[model samples]
Target: MTEPTSANADREVLQMIPKPATAPEIGPWLWAMEETRRGLLRTVRGLEQDALDWRGASGEDNSIGSLLYHIALVELSWLYEDMLLVEPPADIVALLPHPSRAPQGGLQHVESETLAQHLERLEKARADFMRHLTPMTEADWHTFREPPDTDYAVTPAWAVFHLVEHEAGHLFQIREILRRWRAQERAAP
Candidate 1:
């Protein structure tokens, strides 16, 4: 038998939907969410506070800090309100006291927040989500919530998928914002 080359040994295998050893039922969902979180973090890593707070030329209000905060807030909201059907715990509430969007329908200001602080909030929210999700059985993953006075019902599986999509969409926005900010800086005299 031929020996495996070092290049082959060092090659990274990408799992599109990885299964968690402990909880195979929702493992794929968890893996997708983690991938989204990691992508967002990697995109923002090493960014200074000014970069985090930069806005586009049109005065668009979704700063990297606000986007980061919004991502965490929306994930926590979906996990607690939609999946678990419970109020968010006190710690999470404290971490995100304001609404994700202002009355004007723009992202709320996450004022003076450092990249470390935004990352911490994101990590905390994900940890809480995983803690609650880890124990769910296959049945729980398919369980649906039909809130009062609402025509729609949602399942935990769908909620998790939504979280992944939500993060990805915002991460795209963040990349564009970073690109614009860098371009503007380079154009400056």
Candidate 2:
């Protein structure tokens, strides 16, 4: 057989192994979260305030800022309310004071905020999440949680996975918003 190409070797070498930034025991989960965060930041780098507040022609009402706020809220909620089963700390509460979902599941008002402010909120919320997530042992990562009066159950691992997935979904939405905003600008006089 011919030797494998470098691209094939690179693909084989690629793995989800954890990095040193996280606690050794819970490294994989934290690494996933960090990777997701990096993807989000990469997608939105240099995004302008007006572009961030743009809603598409469909009147969907989901702007980049609102999605950023929602992403941060979901991660914090999953960690505190779902995994740890405790109240969110004061700093997190201050960063996102409103309920996670709006009255009609539409976007809440995020126009007053700047892109930098929203990014700062996301970073702060993520720092708090890491602080709480780092202490868990391997067994704790697998611990299941079932909130009162609900059949829904999840583990810390699933919660971290959900955070990553949540940000990814919204990252797509942000990119779409940016694309539409550019199209609108091009179409205008």
Candidate 3:
């Protein structure tokens, strides 16, 4: 695992604020998600096709491309299923062509798709999610959905928080994978 670095105390803008021109009530959450996503994009920037598709020698772990697809899929799923209390709309489903999990109960391994395609899917999912959130009222933000099939309920706020953490965790995994892949490439004869 990578070690942490100290923040520069002199930096002027270390605060978290809502995204600009967004609803004041939900802007903080939006900003947090955006920042988390920025970190994700930074971590994966400039990855080539082999880097995106690389699985460790064991071939059991997810490829970076798979993780990227999973991230986008989960974001849209949470937005529609947990927050909106409905099935994902047709367009959102269209954005994710694969099922969330494979028949063997792992993240479906995504391959062959270019990094550009993965980024496009992520961008579309995020844009749709933000558009839905931009007009939310305070009440909408707090309202909880309790699906009968599950024992738990979630407010939109909680769902957004979960989404942020979920993506952050995967971003860490992607970083580790990239590091390992580079080392493997260098060691190859």
Best candidate, lDDT = 3
Question: What is each predicted model's overall lDDT from 0 to 1?
Answer: 0.85, 0.80, 0.88
Once superposed on the true structure, which residue ranges of model 1 sit more than 4 Å away at CA? 1-10, 16-23
User: Clashing residue pairs in candidate 3, if any?
Assistant: none
TM-score of 1: 0.90
* Candidate 1 vs candidate 3, TM-score winner: 1
Instruction: Judging by lDDT, tell me the better candidate of 1 and 2.
Output: 1
What digit string (tens of lDDT, one per residue) describes model 3 on residues 1-189? 343355876655556767753447688888889998999899888999998988788988899999999999999988887788778778878888888899999999999899889999999999999988888877888898886588899898889889989998999999999989999999999
lDDT of 2 by residue, 100-141 (tens): 677887657577688788889999988888887777777778
TM-score winner between candidates 1 and 2: 1
Worst 10 residues of 1 by lDDT: 14-23
Residue pairs in candidate 2 whose N, alpha carbon or C atoms collide under 3 angstroms: none
- Residues 162-189 of candidate 1 have per-residue lDDT tens digits of 8899999999999999999999989989
Tell me model 2's lDDT, rounded to 2 decimals: 0.80
